[model samples]
Target: MSVFSARTGLAAALAVAALASGGCTQLRSHQGYVVDTDLVNSVQPGVDNRQSVLATLGKPTLAGQFDQGDWYYLARDSRNLAFRNPRPNAQITLQISFDQKGTVTAIRRGGLDQVASIKPYGKKTPTLGRERGFFQDLFGNIGTVGAAGAGGGAGNGSNTGGGGRDRP
Candidate 1:
């Protein structure tokens, strides 16, 4: 190849590599609650009531399932590359529990270390029933209907006036 064409090919290869690298460095996104440390620190246990907590930290992401006095504030930042699953970069969970009087009793903070991943046991569950193969299931009842009909009429034996009964 000529000197000019060689330099041009090198430049084109470099440009392609730069574009590929750019796709890998994606922007991270902050999802759910945004934590303000100063504001969160302002909430004091035993001193802050439910209303004060709400005013200071705004609303919580989740409330305690069985108890109305508990609140949970969750936040996470995730980074995703091109065509890849987003991975959690940072996570914060603040759990605030209240007393019967609606005053803050306990406050706890956690990070990604508290996260748990659970996997399913299997794809299909074993059920209780007669197990039949594909062909048995498809044609199993084809010849049984006539035999069932000849055996008995599976209906209540109540007599109707239209069926050879006298009516005044």
Candidate 2:
């Protein structure tokens, strides 16, 4: 065979081999799903048991901590190329808690799709004294005598308004 034809055949063989074996490529099926939301909502505290919950929902993505009897079903969608920053572009975490009697007690859903981030509420208090911008400190604050004296006149105020470029 000509070298050109032989090289073409070799390329084809390598492509086939790559496809047959799951080589250096992540083949995506373009699909993902969560268990039925309706079915999950149907659970009640008094009626549900640990065994029945497990049977209905299958293995949880996350188990409880300190034997809190909680189970989590997490589903996340994020777009990140290999070796790229992978922040929580999108995420969904469903957590179910059971009483010691193994009955459902609470269910919580958290995801990035909402405006509120998944921050623990009581752990940190919001700081009201964030740093102010230079312009805001100049304009919004008029009662301060030290500030007014510093920029008393237009000559010393350092003309912070829009520079009139189009006007003569």
Candidate 3:
């Protein structure tokens, strides 16, 4: 009945017709990735000490405290939807600590191939009061000055670096 409604209905019908004619398959998602399981199982706990594992596997994907001592091995595949380049998606992790004998007491592994969100690590900067003007700023602190032209001496004061002495 209304013009806007009629136009919307026609557009919907057109989209449906296009789909029936087979044009919507191209819109489906296509994700890319790589999985390295052998590399994953190679560094698990009870296998070897932390230094030995680090020598063989190089480095871990993430090494932080989940509990007392736990390492995480992460192999991920990241793809830019609009580009053809493959990013660094493969990662290995090793959590290590030196005991009385300097040995790896524990280890943990996780094969997280995909992550949707990333949180930045570091201190959060708190908001201060309104900024001050140029002269009123904290960094603009002026020191005690007995005199003003150049220095305690003169030639260097004149910029010729005579140290206030005119060469003969």
Candidate 4:
């Protein structure tokens, strides 16, 4: 083969290799919280109080809505490949509830099974108002332009004194 043809064949092989490598999916990692099983296991119900739980597991991720006695520690790990959306691989939610006296009443844990997917209903919301056509909107105020100010002689050229009162 000629040198020019050999060089062209090498270039084509390199281009094919580059395209094949580009199609490979890369794993993307996402971690919400650092999960420490020892710290979570140390927290005990009825024995551990609010202050003790805070001292053991540090601060919680979220507090209960409407009630201040509930503390929630959330940890999640999601993985995404290529341009697709990230999917949750693992999730841990530790919910610690306190009684009225600030003592730990219940301790619960959840995983990825509790995850819920929510989809939006529509693109635009329906509003309550009058809908007009193109011509109606363009020439809507033609006939009713001076209807309101007609009785006051404002738009009928009757009061053309530049809106200044006569100084005596």
Best by lDDT: 1
TM-scores for all candidates: the values are 0.67, 0.44, 0.32, 0.63
The superposed Cα distance between candidate 2 and the true structure at residue 66, in angstroms, equals 1.7
Better of 3 and 4 by TM-score: 4
lDDT of each: 0.86, 0.70, 0.52, 0.83
Better of 1 and 3 by TM-score: 1
Local accuracy of candidate 3 as per-residue lDDT tens digits, 85-155:
44545443334443444466665433344334555555854558976676676555454233454354443
Worst 10 residues of 1 by lDDT: 152-161
Candidate with maximal TM-score: 1
Ranking by TM-score: 1, 4, 2, 3
Question: Which window of ten consecutive residues has the lowest lDDT sum in model 3?
Answer: 24-33
In the predicted model 1, the residue pairs found to clash are none
- Ranked candidates, highest lDDT first: 1, 4, 2, 3
Candidate 2 lDDT (Cα, 0 to 1): 0.70
Supply the TM-score for candidate 2.
0.44
Model 4 lDDT tens row, 1-168: 699999999999999999887866666575655778998898888899999998998888988876755998988888776778788888999999998888998999999999998877789666689877799989987777557565733666555586576434
Put down candidate 2 lDDT per residue, 1-168, tens digits, no spaces.
699999999999999997766444433221133667777877776788778878887788878786765988877665544445344455667788888878888888887765254646696665688777789877965755455456555655456566844433
Instruction: Estimate the Cα RMSD of every predicted model relative to the unseen true structure.
Output: 4.7, 15.5, 10.8, 5.8
